[model samples]
Target chain A: MFEIFGIPSNALFGQLLIGLINGSFYALLSLGLAVIFGMLNIINFSHGAQYMMGAFAAYLMLKYSGLGYWPALIIAPLLVGITGVIVERLFLQWLYKLDHLYGLLLTFGLALIIEGVARNQLGSAGLPYVVPDELRGGQNLGFMFLPNYRAWVIVASLTICIATWFIIERTRLGAYLRAATENPALVRAFGINVPRIITLTYGFGVALAAFAGVMAAPIYNVSPQMGSELIIVVFAVVVIGGMGSILGAIVTGFGLGVVEGLTKVFFPEASNTVIFVIMAIVLLVRPAGLFGRRA
Target chain B: MEQRVAEPIATPEVQPTVWRTQSATILFVVMVVGLIVAPFFTYPLFLMQAMCFALFACAFNLLIGYVGLLSFGHALYFGWASYLSAYSAKAWGFTPELAILTGTATGAVLGLLAGSLAIRRQGIYFAMITLALAQMMFFFALQAKFTGGEDGIQAVPRGHLFGLIDLSKEMNMYIVVLVIFLAGFLFIYRIIHSPFGEVLKAIRENETRAISLGYKTDRYKLVAFVLSATLAGAAGGTKAIVLQLASLTDVNWPMSGEVVLMTLVGGLGTIFGPVLGSFIILVMQYKLAAVGEWVLVIQGVIFVACVLLFRRGIVGELANKLKIRL
Candidate 1:
């Protein structure tokens, strides 16, 4: 019965929870994008399609193989990551030496093909993905009722994101990645197989997207079009964060997601466009983005 | 490395030989003649649609080819202009000519706004910013009252041109659309050949060098952006009148992608490439209508193929092989 700013506190907290959850996906996806872009200099326009594939992979696994959610989480990303590896070997490898825009175009083509195939097989109408039985219940947090699945999504994504950050920013392997990103020739001179590393880095970035996708399947409808819908907003997030620092991408993703949730509370009409509006404003003020170094 | 080798082949031939000029003139004459007689054999509406898309693709090419800036959200100008022209013709009862002008003006204004912000970034960031802004505009059109939400503005009247010739007839409408397309196409050609266009090309080639030459490169890019947007709007307005409807499909991201595809398939920088590209794509879409969603998959395949094997595009490759400035 308590109210804050003329709206129920429960509603506000609930929206914030939803926003946080959405932000988790944004962080995970953008993290993947930033990591790939750092090493490959390509924006991975198919990131969205890959995310959609992860969800669908889970859906198909459940439908055909009777795989449960727990196992699908591990298997779906592996499957999607292998697909990413094939895509890199077949199409994207040729584009590495070309203008970076070519990579964007190539990936965009991949996205269109993937989405079209999915749409052909499964219509546009969304298919429901049931929350796992263990995560079905909710917790009374006094201020708001938190669904266990939502809590798990937030916690699990944050853990994955942080672990990714630590691996890239704090470990020996991370140093190799940073070194390769900065000077691949130098890294190759050090007897590291940079091309192989590049290929694996791309696959890993794609796996991150798939991981987020599997997490999202339970929350959102498992639909072919879901990734495209979210990817543009994530692109805006990337622009706002400036594809520079890994931590920057993660922070910006979560921040913007919360802001979007707040907008739904105060001005619902602008919810769809608020991120873009912020991107325009950011471009006007700091063209390099909040955490990005000047290009 | 491959791109470096392909660059010399794809660059426009510097020496405008007599043979090249003669071929170009012959091509133009043939195109005009084809436009005049083809309507008799083919459906005028279909031809008109192709012409409109051709203009749109040309406008898009002006930015990507000449200015070296790829705008992924050109549908904002095209779709926004379509809506304005449709609304003016329907509600304000303006003449078709006036309505089209209004649409072009709207595009110019929107271009000024979007280009200023977009020009702040370079390369991939610029493309992404433009696309995000266009997505914002899409949301606006979706919620705005005048756009009529999902149904869009329907039955937009094709009023008399100059308040004289009736455009309700298919022949009259086709002529008006053709004339508009040709004028816009010629104007773009003139822009490319002008001193101003040379500066744009220079900036595209090397921004640092252009700035060192004391040229205000930003102003030049902005101007080119506005010009391209206005022409795109002209195409959109004409299509609105021809089709008698302005829908969300016009403003969506897919439409923007289609324009990019048309330019890429035809020839990114070639004068006549977009026209050919538009026709080929439209005909493909028409023929592939029965295949349902496979059309998208096919378009995707073409995109991949174009990027991988035919980077110079259909006409671009032919021009390179023949050593012509087509």
Candidate 2:
């Protein structure tokens, strides 16, 4: 019966939660992109397809193998990551010396392959994913109600983001990866295998997408198209946040998500386009993106 | 005569060039004849569809080939114009030519806006920006009333051509579509061979150098983008008239990808490549419509194969071998 700004609080809170959840996925995926772009210099167009694969993997694990959410969460990413490694070692490696556009085209082909296969088998309709028993309840915070699974997604993604930031920005292995990204020959001279590192980095980026996929399956539908639309928005986010800094990707992802959530509260029609509008503004003001340095 | 000719430049490829020019002329003549005679052996509607797609791909090639920019969201202009033309012909009862003009102009204006926005970023970023903008338009079409949502603007009339030639006749409509496509194709060819196209190629090859050469590269790019979009819109409008429908599929991202695929398969930079590629793809799609997603897989394979082995594409490679530009 209570209203905030002449609107029902429950609807407002619900949209906010949805926005936050979507933002969490965006943050995770963009973080992966930034990390991969930092070292591998590939935009990972198949990131969305890999995300879809992760969700499908989870679905298949539950359907065919009796795997639960917990196990699939771990298994799906690893499996997807292995596929990423295979793609990198076999096909993607050939594109390193060419224009970056080739990488985009190659990954686009890969995405089509993955999505097409999934569509062939699964059809375009969505399959259901159940929330884990452990994360089934909701907590009433008076101002807004928080579902346990959504809260878990937010916490887990933030934790992962922070951990990834720490690993890349603070660790010794991170230093070598940075060195290799800056100068592959210097890192190779130091007895580091840069090719393996590039492959693993791609795998890592793909795994990040898979993890987001696993997280998203329960919140949204597990469908072939789950990632394609999300990927475009994430691209806009990357453009807005800049692919330069890891921390920038994280902050901008969450920030845009919140802004989108607020837009849904006020003017619902523009909610879908707010991110793009912001990207346009960012382009006009700072073409390099918010956290990106001039190329 | 001996004092003149100040050391004639040595050229090693005159025979090949002459051969290619003859062959190209023969090929165009054959194409014209085939299109004119196609209705006798095959369904006129199918040929019209193929021509529409060929024009679309040719329009797409103008940007990627001449301007050196690859757009991922060209469906916006194509689809939007189809909707406009369809609406005009159906609701406003405009003649077919007028509707097509309206669609093309709509495409040109949208292209101007999108090109202005997308040209801000170079290379892959430009591709992504155009895609995102197109996605925004897709969402708009989905919600907008005139687009009719999932059902799209159906039962669009193939109005008379200038109140004289009835377009309801299959043969007549086919001719109209063919004429529009050929005109658009010739226009693109003219643009590509012109000094303006040279400036676009220069910008694509080296933007910084072109800028330093006292040319405003952005202005040239914007012009190229608008021209490409206008032609693409013309194709879309013709398609709407031919098919008598314009749906979401026309304007979706996948359709954009399809155009890119058509251009890539035909040859990215080749003049006549997209036309051949579009014909092949349309034939394949019509024959394999029942096979479901395998078509996508095959298309993807072709994309990968083209990128890796046949980067010049079917026409581009042939042109290269013949030592003459198409």
Candidate 3:
């Protein structure tokens, strides 16, 4: 019965929950992008496609191998990350010395290939993945009901994102990774395998995207288009956050998602474009992005 | 005379300037001759489609090739122009040329807005900004009233050009399209070959150096971006008039990617690359239209192959091999 700004509290909280869940995915994906760009210097245009693949991987695991969500979460990312490692070794390794745009172009091509192959094999219709038996219900939070799976997504993505930040920013291996990102040759001189590290870093980024995909499968159907549109919005997020700061990416991701959710509550039409509008304003005010240092 | 666009990825052998310019002129003449001759043998509608795309690709080339700014969202200009042109011709009862002009003006204005924002960051950021902005427009078109949502604007009349010459006739339409394509092509050539274009190339080659040398590089880039958008607008408007429709396909991200593919396949910095690339791609699309996503996979393979094996593109390689600056 309560209202805020003439809108129902339930609708407001519902959209906010949706927004938070979406923001968590954005956080997870953008975190991966920042990590990859820091080490590899290329925007993984296929990150979205890889995310879709992860969802599909989960879908297929359930259909073919009788694997549940719990097992697919662990195995799908590993399977996709292994492919990421192979891609790094075979195709992406050659472009490290070239212009950064080449890396984007290459990955974009890879994305098209991956998505096209998937669409060719599977129709573009959404295929549902049932929520696990245990997490099927919702919890009442006084104002609104929250689905347990969505709560799990928010919690799991937040945990994964923080864990990634910690691993890259706090650990000794993280220090070496950052060192290698700064000066690969110097890092190599210290008896560390920098190329191997770069490969793993890329694999890890891919794995993060795959993990988000696994999380997304139950909510949004396992469709080929799951990643394509999401990736563009994520790109806008990257521009707003700027790839220079890892933490900036996470904050911007979550912050923009909440903003988008609020926009959906207040003005429905602009919801599709609010993030882009924000990007334009940010470009005018802070060209380097909110968290990014001057390029 | 400097080729900075594809130079970093692949080092092409440079030829003597005098011979390169002469042969390039010869090549231009040959293209004009071929354009004049091809309509008689080919389907006029398909030819017109190819011409519009060729112009679009060439306009795209002006940015990527000369300015070294790879705008990944060019479909915004191209698609918006088509929509406006179609709406005007169908709704406002404007003549074809006027509708096309309205489209061209839309492109210039949009370009000014997008270019100013995108030029703030160079390289990968520039590409992403343009793309994100374009996608924003795509969402707008999908929701806006006049665009008619997914069905788009259909049955747009091929109104008379300049309120006089009829364009409904196939040959009449072909000639008009030919003139527009040639004029746009020459306009781009003048832009790229002139002092303004040289400054653009200078900016592309090295922005910091250009800025330090007292050239306001952002202004130059913004100007080039506007010009490119204007030309792309003209092409899109022409396409709308010729095809008698404008749809979401024109405004979507794939259309933008298609333009990039055309320029990349033709040659990034080469003069005739986009023209060739557009024709080749249109032909491929025409043939492979039935196979579903195979075309996308093929296009993606081309993108990968071009980036990996031949960044210079077909025309680029030819220019390098023949020791001419195309």
State which candidate has the highest DockQ: 1
Those runs of model 2 whose alpha carbons end farther than 4 Å from true positions after fitting are: B1-17, B21-23
Could you give candidate 3's per-residue lDDT for residues B1-326 as a string of tens digits?
A: 23246673234356446666588788888998988888888888998999999999999999998889889999999999999999999999999989999899989999999999999998889999999999999999999999999999999999788888889989999999999999999999888889999898888788888989999998899999999999999999999999999999999998999999999999998889999999999999999999988888898899999999998899988877876677
Candidate 2: tens digits of C-alpha lDDT, residues B127-208: 8899888988998999899999999999998978989998899888988888998899889989988999889877767778
Among incorrect, acceptable, medium and high, the docking class of model 3 is medium
Q: List the residue pairs that clash in candidate 1.
A: none
Question: lDDT tens string, model 2, A1-295?
Answer: 3688988888888888888888999999999888887777778888999999999999999999999999999999999999999999988888777666667777888888888899999999999999999999999988778899999999999999999999988999899888998999988998999999999999999999999999999989999988889999999999899888999999999999988998999999999989999988888899888998887
Candidates 1 and 2 compared by DockQ, better number: 1
**Which 10-residue window in model 2 chain B sums to the lowest lDDT?**
B1-10
TM-score order, best first, reads 1, 3, 2
Error of 2 at A133 (Å): 1.0
Off by over 4 Å in 1: B1-17
Q: Per-residue CA lDDT of candidate 1, range A149-232, in tens?
A: 999999999999899999999999999999999998999999999888889999999999998999999899999889987888
lDDT values for all models: 0.91, 0.88, 0.92
DockQ for each of the predicted structures, in order? 0.65, 0.43, 0.61
